[model samples]
Target: MPKPEPTELSRPYWDALREGHLVFQRCSCGNAWLPARRHCPHCLKPEPRWERSSGKATLVSWVVYHTAYHPAFESRLPYNVALVQLAEGPRLLTNIVDANEALVADAPVELQIEWEGDTALARFRLAHVTV
Candidate 1:
């Protein structure tokens, strides 16, 4: 798997995930987003604070990939790339683990951090699934 190169602005987010927490930036004007940015996409306000997430989200949409565009992903063909809307209102592009063709939109999901080398990634699984 590939590793993420954290920039000065996004280091906090990556670090938090490494510590087992998901976070996003929110502006006082009531807008929230991910992939950390300098200002609110809604109000364009600077200094959006990093806030921890509840790790709860809903499957908004997704598509199953039948082909691997990257060499690193070749072994994981037929994977699902999903758009999950966080309970706190930010949407993230992530993968749905243990997913199949039976997956549907609006299904509730919870965060599950996985590691690749020393990097931590925020993945998700169906909330009601038993382990």
Candidate 2:
């Protein structure tokens, strides 16, 4: 399997993830971006800077993949992958710890960092959600 690629535009986001912080690009025009970009979508200006988020969110939707499309995900089958609307104003797609179906949609969650050497990927889990 191959490693994931990070473009220059997304370096800050990936870097922040490694440090256990959920940072988003905040534009001077008052817009916040997800999946980080270099220019502000609203103003089309280089008015973006990384800002830390509160790390809180609500599960908007998710899928339980019984199959793995990549070798890296093969051992982690049946994991809950989801899109969460963070308190910071961006919707992030991440994973949740394997929990019961009852805790699927609309559950509150928080961001966590999955470290791989010098890099880390952002993952999420049920916040205060008891097993």
Candidate 3:
């Protein structure tokens, strides 16, 4: 399915996805931003530096969806959608691989970049956990 276009506020996020990195804006004023804002909410500074994320995250919650909100998603029904807590302290909403569902709840997952057309979005997969 064709991916949707990103707005100006979300361009950096899509760009970072294409580069195979999870980049978030961090201000020297001790602020970490999410949702790709134009400036730090606390200090109100523009052009914050892009920080490379560790790609490490833990699943916070998930639901096994059986419904499709769009026709493009009908084939992907029964998939698991989840919210993950990034190691960097941001919460990311993403999809979890089905093969890893047994380990999903509270399980660690790593960020993966998938390009659909010119746009790229970040996804997640099971993180190899060692006993």
Candidate 4:
């Protein structure tokens, strides 16, 4: 697995995830986003504050990849790359773990942070699926 290189702007996000907290930037205009942007995509205001997520989300769309575009990912072939809309309104590109079959659109999901080596990532699972 590849490691994440966090820039200064994205450090807070990665750091929060490492502490088992999912956070995003929220603008005064009622917009929230991920991947750490300095300005709100909607209002163009700077310094959006970091807010913790409820860890709740909905599956918007996804595709199962049977082939790895990179050799490092070959061992994890047949994975799902999903677009999940967080309850706070930001959509994120993430993987749906333990999804053996097709996931239904709008299925509720919850955050399940995991580590790749020492790097933490924000992944999710079906709300109904148990650990």
Candidate 5:
């Protein structure tokens, strides 16, 4: 597997994930996103603050790939890549930790930190909330 090479701007995000927290950049204009950019993806402002997520999100969409786009992923073929919108408004591309057939639009999900070698990755699973 190809490990993430954290750049200066993205280092904090990766470091936080390593410490078991999921965070995003929140601009003054209220836009938030992942994969750390220098400017707000919505308003084009600089140096947004990082905010820890509540670890809740909603399933937006997904696709199950039968073929590995990279040789490192050949063993995990048929995995689903998903789009999830966080409770705080930003959306990210991630994988759901459940059966591909169980996915549905708008399903509530919660964060589940997973590891790829030494790198921490943020994946999700159906929320198991208790009343």
Candidate 6:
């Protein structure tokens, strides 16, 4: 598996995931985001505060990759890559841990951290669904 190369700015995000907490950067302008940056993208402010998530999210959209885009992912072919929006307002690309057939539009999801070597990945699973 290709591992994440955490930059100085993103180290804290990785560390928090490792410690079992999912966090996001919130600026004074009230914008929160992920894959951290030195300045807030909204107000261009420096040093936004970090806040822990409630581990709650909403499934926005997703697609199943029947073909591997990278060699390392061949074993995991036909996986669903989803766009999920956190309750606090940040959206991230992640995987949904549920049967592809069970996925539904706007389903509620909760955090599910998975480990890759020493890196903790922030994935999610369905909270409940009917369809």
Instruction: Give the root-mean-square deviation of each candidate in angstroms.
Output: 2.1, 2.6, 2.2, 2.3, 1.2, 1.8
For TM-score, candidate 4 versus 6, the one ahead is 6
Q: For candidate 2, lDDT tens digit of each residue in 1-131? A: 35558898887777777777988888888888798776888899885888999989998988888988887888877777788888878888878764747566787888877775666778877788567
What are the per-residue Cα lDDT tens digits for candidate 5 across 1-131?
A: 98878999999989999999899999998888987899988889898999999999999999999999899989998899999999998899999999999999999999999998789999999997687
Give the TM-score of each candidate: 0.95, 0.85, 0.83, 0.94, 0.94, 0.95
Tens digit of lDDT per residue, candidate 1, span 7-125? 99999999999999999999999899998999999989999999999999999999998999999988988899999999999999999996577678899999999887899999989
Clash counts for all predictions: 0, 0, 0, 0, 0, 0
In candidate 3, stretches whose alpha carbon ends up further than 4 angstroms from where it belongs are: 42-46
Local distance difference test scores for all models: 0.92, 0.80, 0.79, 0.90, 0.93, 0.92
Residue 24 lDDT (model 1) = 96
Among these predictions, the greatest lDDT belongs to 5
**Candidate 2 vs candidate 4: which has greater TM-score?**
4
Better of 3 and 5 by TM-score: 5
Model 5, residue 66: distance off in Å is 0.8
Which residues of candidate 2, in runs, are more than 4 Å off? 100-102, 129-131
Give a tens-digit lDDT track for model 4, residues 22-122. Answer: 99999989988987999999989998999999999999999999989999889988888999999998889999996649588989999999998899999
Clashing pairs in 2: none
